[model samples]
Target: MELLPFDEYVRSLDRKRMSAGVLFRDAEGRVLLVEPSYKAQWEIPGGSVDAGESPWAAASREVREELGIERVFTRLLVIDYVPDDGRMPEGIAFVFDGGLITNAEVAALELTDPEIVSAGLFFLDAVPSLKATLAARLAIALRAAQAGEPLLSENGTELT
Candidate 1:
């Protein structure tokens, strides 16, 4: 029996990019959003999961790297499978709860990463207006928040 070459086998599978992020809310339940210098719209605090990294770990690392804050995630919120768009390869996206934050915690946030321009809180209802993709993802997050359970989604629609 002959086995396929390693490179050939690997190349046969679709490549996807994995990313992880956390959602933080203020006492009023406003969601925390960050303006990425590279993107036209704001995003939540998180980034791509590095090789050999767990989604949870990547989410924590992204928050620390981007916002210069150390916070524990409360629980898994959503796992979304985004299809590949022309501009980006599709992959699984994870959202975890960074838990509630106070005004002091918000003030303590620093944009240490060059990619982050600023961070602010916005009403959950306002998230969809930020960007097309954000609207979809936020929908799932909102459901997760309400149900207090992990949700599976595709692009932004929650899977039953």
Candidate 2:
């Protein structure tokens, strides 16, 4: 891979933190994974929140832009922060529970960014290895859904 200019690389390395939205299983418990051509991981569908955008709005917008499906509803699942960075600028991953639907209504799955190689749905029991934090979040979301609680786990832990 080509390297970035020294100043630009330094600026990125120095930027301490940001927030990301995570969209996992749709309402029915089917897992959704996106492989954006630009990103190496088959990430949960969400992105950085723009300045002034609420987490809920950010989630919906990202789903629309990245997945092309309307995220009809979304709410806070949890606020996750990695603490080693002093938390001043830690990635506050906001997990969002989005509606259950497929893109077949308008067309086959489309990637807002061409770099997205493809999208797939997998059975929960068959989910592949996922990034650690994201896998935890998915387990949380699925547990919430199976129990009919949107924002709380059966163990009395709030999903958020």
Candidate 3:
């Protein structure tokens, strides 16, 4: 993974920024997660899309940037929005799923934005530590991935 100056690159663009994330899983089906140097919580790898980039393209681009090696066979999972809290601008997020190869050189990236960064593989049982929205997103994505129930309402009943 190459460490281009993220903030420096961000400032260089005259483009609207968007982002996409991929939930990477190993051959054994364990999830690959990053302990972000910036974020206090763990997150899947992804980041902003430059001008003229599609979300799929951005997902691949961001994953390569953040993870150092590009192996994302990405599929779009969802689109989400976080509104501004009067302090920060809103964010548009695209979430996807990918398969990770364990042999990839994951050690090359600095993971520097937050500090004390590390990566890990965890079983599904460890998902509870994730932030609620992320947990929901991951759950929904995985369910879709597994061909979840269709035509069902939020409750137990089927939609008319």
TM-score of each: 0.85, 0.66, 0.62
**By summed lDDT, which 10 consecutive residues of candidate 2 come out lowest?**
151-160
Candidate ranking under lDDT, highest first, comes to: 1, 2, 3
lDDT measured at residue 70 in model 3 versus the true structure, 0 to 100: 58
The lDDT values for all models are 0.83, 0.62, 0.61
Report the candidate with higher TM-score, 1 versus 2.
1
**Alpha carbon lDDT at 102, candidate 2:** 60
lDDT of 3 by residue, 60-88 (tens): 87666666555654466556665564765
Task: Give the better candidate number (1 or 2) by lDDT.
Answer: 1
lDDT of 2: 0.62
Clashes of 1: 0
**Candidate maximizing TM-score:** 1
Cα error, residue 102 of model 3, in Å, equals 4.5
- Spell out the clash pairs found in candidate 3: 1-68, 37-114, 37-115, 38-114
User: Which digits, one per residue and each the tens of the lDDT, describe model 2 over residues 1-160?
Assistant: 9999999898888432445555555445677877777746666777787877776787777778877867644556655654444534545566676646464532476676775677777554565545655666667766655655555332223343
CA-RMSD of model 3: 11.1
Q: Which regions of candidate 1 fall more than 4 Å away from where they truly are?
A: 1-11, 72-74, 127-129
Candidate 3: where are CA atoms >4 Å away?
A: 1-17, 27-29, 71-74, 85-87, 100-116, 124-129, 148-160
Q: Report clash pairs, candidate 1.
A: none
